[model samples]
Target chain A: MKEGNFCCHKTTERSEKEYKSLMNRLSRIEGQIRGIKGMVERNVYCTDILIQVAAVNAALNSFNKELLAEHIRNCVVRDIREGKDETIEELVVILQKLMK
Target chain B: MKEGNFCCHKTTERSEKEYKSLMNRLSRIEGQIRGIKGMVERNVYCTDILIQVAAVNAALNSFNKELLAEHIRNCVVRDIREGKDETIEELVVILQKLMK
Candidate 1:
């Protein structure tokens, strides 16, 4: 592949709507995180804090899953169609790491 | 702060050298991944494959650590300096998720 083509595949572009949605989710998560910090500072119970932490974790994981799914559908699939076997391996490694 | 300033801190810019170095490491990992696939196709021992998987995981984690460190130093620090407490919460959440 041409260097430019390779470069293009190296990064994914998000539409404005997609970007706004992601930022909105991130901002909401940010608020939850601050709440957690306030809980920490106010001597909240460990179990309660842990529960909130778990929720935050689940939220972030959900976000990451969506991003990874988009990556696979866009970048990985494009690379495969363009005859880039290396990207397949790259993606496999990425997925295994994410799973871990 | 102006919206442009906020936008600037929202993304981190990497130097060419840094970008090249990351891509090099990624490429090496990619090759290792292909090797793993070949091993799988040839019916390599499960333990052996698992070991390689662990190595790849470690490498990827290391890469992520470096990137996150840079992010904290550049984007997060700048945001904090600019009086964006929200970014602090964002980063704390990000770090907590990364740790998991």
Candidate 2:
């Protein structure tokens, strides 16, 4: 884990390509974000802004869901395999938070 | 993101030490988590298990709050300074989810 990096697991040898693809998606999303800011600065209609806001929200939630899927497949499953049942509790706690 | 790593930002040159410290705390919490699982496997009192579960929840929440604070200070603030108001909407959406 690095200061700005919230990832707890070390990068796997095979995930570099996937990581790059995810970053590309995030970059495009980042640009769309800038477009929204421009719209706000131009005094765009509140309803229009709100619509864009909703789109962004959906996009972000999708991204988070994908990341969470990966986390469960990789981290949580590995813990279970290693007989680390306690990690299940950690995951349950995380799930509870996410559900909230 | 690298498979299991959820961090979106590149590590700064300065946060290595802080990251290590955070990981150490996480390791301790992880051990406590295993203890909870052992209690469960032993068919310990349900009330005792629930108490431990609550403690784990609080501990995890505190950890997440600290991480979120760091994220806001680093990622959100940087986006704002770079004229990215749309990032505010992203954060607002995230906060709404967290509050839920």
Per-residue alpha-carbon lDDT of candidate 1 for residues B12-38, written as tens digits (9 for 90 to 100): 355666556555655655555566555
Model 1 lDDT tens row, A12-91:
46556655555565455556656654553443433344456556556555555655666677767877899877777766
* Proportion of native contacts present in model 1: 0.00
* Per-residue lDDT of candidate 2, residues A1-100 (tens digit): 4212775543322166645544454455455556644553443433344455455445545544655566578766876998868767876876675555
Model 2 clash tally, residue pairs: 4
TM-score of chain A of each: 0.85, 0.78
- Give the docking tier of candidate 1: incorrect
Model 2 bad stretches (over 4 Å): A1-100, B1-14
- What is candidate 2's TM-score for chain A? 0.78
Q: How well does chain B match by TM-score in each candidate?
A: 0.82, 0.79
List, for all models, the DockQ compared with the true complex. Answer: 0.02, 0.02
Q: Over 4 Å off in model 1, which ranges?
A: A1-9, B1-100
Clashing pairs in 1: none
Candidate 2 chain B, run of 10 with poorest lDDT = B1-10
